[model samples]
Target: MAIDVGIIQDVETLLKNLNGYELLSYAICNEECGAETYEWLAGRVEGILVDEFRYLAKEKRKHAAELRKLFEELYPGMKPLEFNAPPLDTLPVCRELMKTKELENALAIAMLSETIGRDIYRKLQRMSGDEEVAELFKRLAEMKEAAYEKLLKLYEAMEK
Candidate 1:
């Protein structure tokens, strides 16, 4: 069976980034729950988010959609949950020593997550056959990189 090049590459991208995706999703979930927000059914919702992380790895499309829903709730109108930083399960290790401020850790995670997402988007943008989607990803990557730079400045200030 001749494979559709686009489909194959998309799958390849997913496979390549599966581990990172899970970790990144997990990180966002952890950060969301990290704060003791008594917003709705926090436990159940958080549980779902965590579950979605594994699901994304095992079933990309479905899991990605589910995770998007979780992020939609988390960020409301704006799509929060950066995709660049290490996956949630491994983010703690990927991030530096954040012994002091929880906020700092959160900031770092979000910053890195967005930064990484930008890079991925850029790559996908090039690979995408759809001109509009490619444009979207290109724009997204720029925005993410900008956000990451802002976070870097913030971190630098905090360090001093």
Candidate 2:
């Protein structure tokens, strides 16, 4: 008795075909860029909130100490997401998908940060396997849930 196990995993092929960032960034950017105008305050608001999260992650010096370092290594910028970024006062409606790579790259980065935030709580819950930390994860998850809700509201506004 034998089984025909003809299975192969092509790592390089998989990597080449993977638009991991593109897919995720597209989701994040389109959520905002889908707006009637990127100059629209909605996109700008969400962008700023996302930036604030990056700051918090950087400042969490106790438990999540290495987060900022890893963030820098993975992406080395202030996300070009200024607290007071260039205004959209007179710019034409940026109604098209990002034409150049820079905007798309920035969006990809934004998605990555959101993703890491999601992972942190989820991972803590899994790794806790105990009373205290598990409870902490539960609390953290709820926090994330609220943040997601707020983000959805912004996205919904963008949709309008």
**Total clashing pairs for each candidate:** 9, 0
- Which 10-residue window in model 1 sums to the lowest lDDT? 34-43
Which pairs clash (backbone N, Cα, C closer than 3 Å) in model 2?
A: none
lDDT of 1 by residue, 25-64 (tens): 5434433432222121123233333332233233323334
Instruction: Compare the candidates by TM-score and give the number of the best one.
Output: 1
lDDT of each: 0.44, 0.34
Q: Name the 10 consecutive residues with the lowest summed lDDT in model 2.
A: 82-91
Q: Which stretches of candidate 2 lie over 4 Å from their true place?
A: 1-116
Please, what are the lDDT tens digits per residue for candidate 2 over residues 1-160? Answer: 1111121123223223434232222222222322222233223444444454343333322222232233344446733121221112111212222332343333433333334345445544554434544454455455545545555554455456
